[model samples]
Target: MMEMILKTKQVSEELGVNPSTIQRWVKFFNLPCQRNEHGHYLFNEKHIEELRKIKDQLSEGLAMTDVQIDIPKKEAVKTKEFTLNNEIEKRLDKLIMRIDNMERRLETKADEVVSAQLLQHRLEIDDLVKKINSLENTLLEMQEKQTFQMQDYHSDFMLEKPKPVKRSWFASLLQLFSMIKS
Candidate 1:
């Protein structure tokens, strides 16, 4: 008579539980399991029967401590180590997901910062343009004032001096006769 050995998946299927759950059960409840040459767990029919009993007890709302199954000390230690390793792996996966989420958020924040800076730069450029326009208008007004002042000065300079009073002919004759008598 050959004993039938089943893999974890097969046992989980037969028991209607997940494979990981089966491993946890094997660890916690100290269900008898044989390790294959490849270091995988193999369960025999007797092991299955023991698992069924444990499952029944659990389904009946019995606490693990109250189940009253004697497990070997060495096997319990091994199971504890396995459970701890599984826990660590699960925690590491969660931490990796958190880090990924944080990186995405940081990228989003950086984009927003760049956008804000661009808007600020645009506003500064607009202000400078307005100031330049104002300065140009002032310069044009000053030039116009200077041109009007120059035209006024030119008109003043061009005014002709009053013509010298014309000499009378009588006055000229009297001056000549006086000179001849002398």
Candidate 2:
């Protein structure tokens, strides 16, 4: 006897919810759902049970991310209907691939964030260097102006004085003799 696989509509009606909600749960929560050859979700009794539990958790005011789920390995039904080892290997491979993809995405995001921070710091340093150069040029100009003013002040005060007259004593004696004769 084969196990009955239910469609999305049937599961939705059974759970009294919309089909889109079931699809969302399967996609976002990685609910163990298999796709048919026509690319439609094929949910077994166990998958439906899991969906019911998810609905109950949501109804109890639990956040979607906080709702943890554990998917158990598929076991042989009755007379070894399927090879247990092969199924385990396939599931393990799929899980490893998913883990690798997540690792790559995390590394890429971290690198992008670091690069953005470095670029911001580089731009800020460039602006500061420009401001420093501008201030240096202003100081040099002020110093040059001060040097020129000092040179002009010194030239005015360092000039030579004129010599005194040399005939002062002879002129004084002649004026005294003339006064006596008068």
Candidate 3:
């Protein structure tokens, strides 16, 4: 089977590295490559494997100068997976923050609604209090009028002279006797 060959751009994409880095790797690390007619470097699977090994060693805290190109056991790249997970976490965090903001806004709106209702109730209470005061004042005026009328009736009744009562003849005889005695 023929080996699959890829251009510099394709290698850059596969390695998740810059095309310049791949070119530098070709020059500095002596990365295996074939020159096309245009003198552009073409990479094969072997070169990709060696790049993966170098990347692994770099990730393991080895300096670029210290990294060896010899292929270790083949393993999947962790950077891509790590990037995806990081992105997902970031999105979830944003979503959580948005939800929290919405909740706060809803709470504020609810508080405003309650405040408005309370204000309306207070207005109603104020109106009721005013009406009650008006009624009380009217009642007080009515009472004052009734008390004046009672006082006037009482005074009028007292102003009238009482009629004299006729005494019995026996009571008149007793009175005449008493006058004689005096």
The top-ranked prediction according to TM-score is: 3
RMSD of 2: 14.8
lDDT of 1 by residue, 1-182 (tens): 99899999999999998888778778766666889999779999877877777778888998554554444665444456655665775688899999999999999999999999999999999999999999999999999999999999888878967788877999989989999999
Candidate 3 per-residue C-alpha lDDT over 72-173 given as tens digits, one digit per residue, 9 for 90 to 100:
324322345545554665688899999999999999999999999999999999999999999999999999999999999999999999989989999999
Clashes of each: 0, 0, 0
Worst 10 residues of 3 by lDDT: 71-80
Q: lDDT at 80 for candidate 2?
A: 29
Which portions of model 3 miss their true places by more than 4 Å?
A: 1-84, 165-182
24-66: candidate 2 lDDT, tens digit per residue: 6776566768888888899998899889988999899986656
lDDT at position 175, candidate 2:
85
Global CA lDDT computed for model 1: 0.81
Deviation in Å, model 3, residue 98 alpha carbon: 1.6
Candidate 2 backbone collisions, by pair: none
Looking at model 2, report the run of 10 residues with the lowest lDDT sum: 73-82
